[model samples]
Target: MNTNDLKIFEAVAAHGSFTKAAEATFTVQSNVTARIKSLEEEFGVELFTRTSRKVALTTAGETLMQYCKKINHLIDEAKYDIKNAGQIIGQLKIGCIETTMALKAPEIINYFAENYPDVDLEFRSAMRSTLISEVLNFKLDAAFVSAPVSQPELDQIHIRDEQLVIVSSAQTAKISEVLNKQPVKIIVFDQGCIFRARLESWLSAKGIIKYKSIVLNSLEGIINFVEAGLGITILPAEVMEHYYAGRKLIAFPLNKELGTMTTVLIYRKDVPPSRALQVFADMHKVQG
Candidate 1:
């Protein structure tokens, strides 16, 4: 019944931990527990299924979360209208693949930060697979990903092309030159990474299915591995040039099929776009 109760409920749902939710909301754990108990009594329904380690939303809580987001969004907009003259002032959570950070995200983020000083902007780096699901689940406001997503529930915009290149240490043989005789050593992100899948597909099509694989999380890590002659990796040409051009690495064009990737901006189509989202789209449109 109380607005504070809703805030506490939302925090608990987001964190799945009463202690963590309490810390987030600047309250003691017992207070959080009491507020949640009061909320359950007021609503006449149990909101969460509790366990020793964590809590999960019950069906009623699941239903309520959608309404909670809407209510909070409306409240944020009303506050913005009254105090900030309808300027962007609420939270915007945008995600992007790691490569976008090197190419487009910095510029867009800088522009948005300068233009809308009151907005709370969160930039999360995520794999496309994870980013898509997060966007669909309303965990992310929008995401920049590799284009042509298959989800019917989402909408996308073609942003730009990322020119991918194979970077190998100068001492290593060219990919085509080495593949027939031996498997080309490759550095890749993780299994679900779209770029990793693309590289694997390209290698498979070359009849070179086997390669020594090295896993790394960051682009810098990949570059370092490739520069040490450990393996070759495919990354944005611009990124490689800007960051590792001084290093002892050679860049070769990828097979046309795998060389150029279209960067796409994706968001849920089912929900009306928020003003912050609208401004994000506009910023990209104007710059891109």
Candidate 2:
């Protein structure tokens, strides 16, 4: 009936489990149950069905949930509109890819924090896929993700375009030479990585698929290995150009489609961000 109850209902619907919703909402399980009960009593319909292990929504619950989501989004928009009418102040949880941490994230965070000290900010580094899912589920206020991600449940704003380039040790002058070697040692992030996927696809298409690759879980590890002359790797030209020591690496462009990528700001399509987030987003919005 009220906003708090609606928030609880939204969280429960998102996670499909009361306990999980409670944890995400930073409340107790009893509180989540009570809010759901109140909503059910007011609407005269059950919103969830619980069995031994899992919980799901019935037809009535599904219908009510759709309306609940709309109502919740409307309330959020109204709040954002009012708060942006003046100085912004609140907490915002932001997500980013590990590659964006060094310069992009720190600059943005520092700029916002210094100007709006009253607003609290939290940062996280995650894979692009995970960041997208978290934003859609409302677990994150917004995120910086590798761009051109097409998802119906999210809104994306293109921030910057990044060109893909091959990075090799300072001692290695040519990539073709490495490819001809016995199982060319390559370092990369795992399967879920956009850069890694693109690199593999490009290599396969180019008839250069006989190389061995090491799959690292972190960007730092990948760069370190490449820096140590262990192998070669690929990354965003903008990011790599800014952070990497030029003396330790040489970067080359990929041919066409595999050559360029974009970084974007992403958030839930239907949910508006808080005032503090809006200010930051507005500042970073790409100019025409």
Candidate 3:
């Protein structure tokens, strides 16, 4: 019932485990357990069902946890707003896809840093879905994710549309000729990658099936795999310019109707905007 108890319950629900949630909240497992137990006692309802290996939320837990997330977010936002009202001197954590680091990150960070030297910035790069989740969970103040994010709680602002180009080794011209060829290695990032989903759907539409693949966690790994003639990959044109400059990779267009991949800035709409986030969001409003 208390804010501390609700915070503990929220952490447990988000992580789906007591031990993991304890680590995340910088507390011990016993404290997390006691807090949740106190909360359940006060509510006269069992919030979570305990199994030997996993924790599952009961109906009451699910409903309560949803509201807890909102309450916790509000508390954090209020603190951020109060502390940063007149100055910009707090740590701002933003998340992004790995490719965003190449050029866009430097330009944006340099501009922000030079203008507001007191505000410390931290950029965490990961798969797009992970970034989206972090923003939703309040772990990140904001995130730049490949767009079409349909989550109701998050507000998304379109930044730029980057072309998704299919690239193959130049020496393997025959691979380009046959859209549904054998020995096709689809080099892709892990599950949460936006382009990886796009490429799979594209292949399905073209009736190209049974292709080989290599799962890589980083942009550079995918690029290296493709450059070594190990496979072909799809990537945003703007972000991949350096990799394409003198490589044996040949770029091909996805059909025009497929459209460009959209880069978007997403943050919780209901949360009071932090000074750091407000400044960052303002930069996305491209002047005509």
Q: Encode model 1's per-residue lDDT on 162-249: one tens digit a residue.
A: 7888778887555666565465788999888877888788788777777877999998888888889787788888887777778989
Please give the distance, in angstroms, between residue 200's alpha carbon in candidate 2 and its true position after superposition. 0.7
Give the winner by TM-score: 2 or 3.
Answer: 3
Model 1 Cα displacement at 228 (Å)? 0.7
Off by over 4 Å in 3: 7-46, 50-56, 178-181
Residues 1-288, model 2: lDDT tens digits: 787787788788788899999998899999999999988898888888988776788788878766676676567758766766676777788898778776577777688778988788898988888988887656788898887778887777777777889888878777787777777778988768888888888778868778788988888888888888888888888777677766588887798788877788887666556677767777777440
Lowest lDDT 10-mer window, candidate 2? 279-288
The positional error of residue 249 in candidate 1, measured at the CA in angstroms, is 1.3
Supply candidate 2's per-residue lDDT for 124: 92
Best by lDDT: 1
lDDT of 3 by residue, 111-130 (tens): 87789887788988988878
* Number of colliding residue pairs in model 1: 0
TM-score of each: 0.74, 0.77, 0.81
True-vs-predicted CA distance for residue 19, candidate 2, Å: 11
> What TM-score does prediction 2 earn?
0.77
User: How large an RMSD does model 1 have?
Assistant: 4.5
